[model samples]
Target: MNEKIPQQSLKGCKPEIHYPCVWQYKVIGMERQAIQAALSKKLGDAPYSLSESRTSKQGKYISLNLELTVHNEEQRLHLYSALTADPSIKLVL
Candidate 1:
């Protein structure tokens, strides 16, 4: 005898797919580790990765690239706002 699965079993079982959002910051007046620490404190436990590089031909400032898993526009905007509000952050993209 063959068994049939109930349709209700699949209800509310839709898969969730997350897309990584990237933010590039031309950060100044602070070290990369400090920025990363600040971000971690602001964004909480959300999964993220950071990469930083000093600009070519200039040792005055550095750029930080942040990769995070975001669910909606609000989250992205919030992150941008928080980063921009910091005095050490020069630019955000």
Candidate 2:
């Protein structure tokens, strides 16, 4: 799902990012409700925005764009890891 990702890093160099920034993550799953539940479990009471992206032609899968403010790279990666670890979530990008 990372099609044509932007070149943020060069080899081993990490991209510089300001702290407490809003990040966007594309979460793909089987069902809308299931995706919401999984996100709730992972995010707790944290505020976030979730919007439908698109569904497979057969309606087998759905992708949602999730936006939330991350305090640092660690928090951002932690959230990504949590989303990927959920059984209901198929992929995160």
Candidate 3:
């Protein structure tokens, strides 16, 4: 279970994030379609928004902004792990 720490104590340790809140991930990869498929496969029925971000001048790489609701730190971290594990995904922020 996740315990909430008072705002005043946030400076002493980990930053406090309310659960079931929207989270964002910046996904960088070579192809937009591959990233989209990976997101769809991993998220399943979860609702999310995916948009184009920066792209290399030579068109070798691109970044996509991903926004979705994450219930807790575990789920958030799990998503990051799964995304980074994909071969089509180069980086996740």
Candidate 4:
């Protein structure tokens, strides 16, 4: 006869986690390098990556794609707060 396993036998299973949340930023009156530096400082030693591009309509603005490899939702919130606090950063998306 076949027998079924008891409940709680699969307690070792772990849920999956997503990494490197993608974020975009709209920054005005700031150079690419300056934004990068500011982000680097805010992230501390965690080592995040960024991509930047420029767009013009009525004036010049720089768009940045930020990647955080080891940050959670709360951490992401903090990062956004920090970036927005900077005078050079016009917007965070």
| lDDT of candidate 3 over 1-93, digit per residue (tens) | 999868787666866899999999999999999999999999999999998989989999999999999999999999999999999999999
Give residue 57's error in model 3 in angstroms. Answer: 2.2
Ranking by TM-score: 2, 3, 1, 4
Top-TM-score structure, candidate number = 2
**lDDT (0 to 1) per candidate:** 0.68, 0.95, 0.96, 0.68
Compose the digit string of candidate 1's lDDT tens values, residues 1-93: 898979999798955544444444444445666677677777888777776756535666667777766766677678788888877666777
Tens digits of per-residue lDDT for model 4 on 3-90? 8868698588754556555544554445676777777778778755676655657546777777655456676667778889977677
Summed backbone clashes in each candidate are 0, 0, 0, 0
Model 4's alpha-carbon lDDT is 0.68
- lDDT (Cα, 0-100) at 63 in candidate 3: 98
- Candidate 4's C-alpha runs over 4 A off are 1-29
lDDT of 3 at 32: 93
Predicted structure 3: clash tally: 0
Better of 1 and 2 by TM-score: 2
Candidate 4 similarity to native, TM-score? 0.61
TM-score, every prediction: 0.63, 0.87, 0.84, 0.61
What value of lDDT does candidate 3 attain over all alpha carbons? 0.96
* Prediction RMSDs, each to the true structure: 12.1, 5.2, 6.8, 10.8
Q: After superposition, how far is residue 83 of candidate 2 from its true place, in Å?
A: 0.6
What digit string (tens of lDDT, one per residue) describes model 2 on residues 1-93? 676755664567777899999999999999899999999999999999999999999999999999999999999999999999999999999
lDDT preference between candidates 2 and 3, better one: 3
